[model samples]
Target: MSTAWQDLTGRARLRDAAIEAFAAQGFEESLRSIAARAQVTAGLVRHHFGSKDALRAECDATVLERYRQLKEESLQADPHQLFTHLPASAQGGVLLLYILRSAREGSAAGRKFTEQLIDEALILLNQSVSRGLIVPSRDEPARARLLILQSLGALVLHFALNPPQDPEDFAAVMQDYYSRVALPTLEIYSEGLFTDSAYLNEYLLATAADVPPATDAGITESR
Candidate 1:
């Protein structure tokens, strides 16, 4: 459990329990089960949040905010620390699993939750550019959205293919998954696949009518 879940009272305790329960068992997890996890009554849960839907929305907000905080902290640390912890923390963290469940459940709130994530990514990437940690993009919004999509899309596919026996095993499963991908991902980022940007330049020229030609450093980031 996260230290964030510790030393809680009333509504806060219920919220943390709901995050854990929903992450483990999906959104269909009963209020009674969540209440039991928090050592509270279901009626108390209803009293605080009114409905399961409201509780879920609250969980979504909490998860997103937690992610934002973690990422901001990583930005202030060694940039590579983020990727080093990505497999376990970002992939296996309860907050992330909860968001993934939201996306898989296909609820309206679920879709909105994902859109919110992308928006958050946009803000973070803009910060990165402003700090000169990363090069500015010709189309900043597109690049931000693409990075989030590629990352979360790959994670969604990973879980679908290798469904864990228990949610508690999320960290182990994701760590193993990242072990397989980490080297190649690092290599691709460190070493360009193509010898030159001829193909990209040609494509840019072809599409110049729609937008002005501008070269971006792809994924340039300061160490």
Candidate 2:
């Protein structure tokens, strides 16, 4: 498919092309092919971005930032509603492309992008906790990473096992999959793991005679 490469500035076109190529293939995909897709010389791509790694890093920011924006927008009331609330257009293709590609390469760009993805999910989880939907936990960061991995692993695996077909059908299938399966599976997560009666209550009961009960139901961090 031919794109109007000139419609974008040289740098923009290169970034766009890199995102396309990385999304279609992987980061290990040839820079020459990306330049050709952008209608520029391979050296021009290097001139614009220094190297293929840098180019893929730029693409990672481009696509994942948009993915984050879509996530933020869809998070209307409940953060747990993330996937189910996403529009069909924002459903799983490009983000998974970049993620899968980056994980395989294990390069600087890959690690940075992966960290960024985790950080973004952590932010959303914090939002949910702040909204009082999820209780805060001492292990918020680790739990956030687990949540991100759960969603991402499912998406990455879905793409691997069942490649994209008709766009409408794919969206419907994904939406159904999330509502019927993923949402329920992750439903307990939004409650925060510490909510279980296993420890917090017992701790409170044990300490009841020693100190006044802490008003905040969330776990406190040990200094």
Candidate 3:
């Protein structure tokens, strides 16, 4: 392959490594550690990404890509298939952990990434409403924002009390909570027209099945 191709491959590898490291260990881990995992030098990491902050931004992008893929796959499968397939811990654990760590440390990148994630989620929720999956009231955006905030708060509380559990265990708890709390809350708030357990389950399944299209020009452009 040409030098450019090799460079691109290396950069991609570095980015993936950064994602895994950040997801697993947060920003506390050094760039050198990330580079070692990717089998590249720290200098190369800097050369390609320019700075740690920039590399972190790339990591956020990678995580978002994975999120989109998981959501698509879930959606395409039988309703709520992802909840059955992915442990609740793994589904939202990394992002939750990252958020908690960032907030505790007062990291700007973490805050920014979290905001971006929320924005993306809101967009998807609106899209789901348009598709007749969720029925948000006139104040759909506000309601959606509250739901996201509550869910994140729950995650932080859970993680604070215990070490991260296995994904399956997390998934089981999430399934139960969604069935008991989230679904019911949505129904009550939306006057039984916005979302129900069945609909939410179906939506979660679809999102898990979703495999974010390769040509996400529109998604990128929206940002």
Top TM-score: which candidate number? 1
Pitting candidate 1 against candidate 2, the one with the higher TM-score is 1
Ranking by TM-score: 1, 3, 2
Judged by lDDT, which candidate is best? 1
**Comparing 1 and 3 by TM-score, which wins?**
1
Can you give the lDDT of residue 206 in candidate 3?
81
The segments of candidate 2 whose C-alpha lies over 4 angstroms from its true place after superposition are 1-8, 77-87, 90-92, 163-223
Candidate 1 segments whose C-alpha is farther than 4 A from its true place: 1-8, 79-92, 215-223
Tens-place lDDT digits, model 2, residues 102-126: 7656677767777888998888879
- Per-residue alpha-carbon lDDT of candidate 1 for residues 49-161, written as tens digits (9 for 90 to 100): 99999998888898899989877887788757767776776334576577668767777997898889899999998998899776677787787788777877776887798
TM-score of 3: 0.67
lDDT of each: 0.78, 0.67, 0.64
Residue pairs in clash, model 1: none
Candidate 3 lDDT trough over 10 residues, lowest sum: 214-223
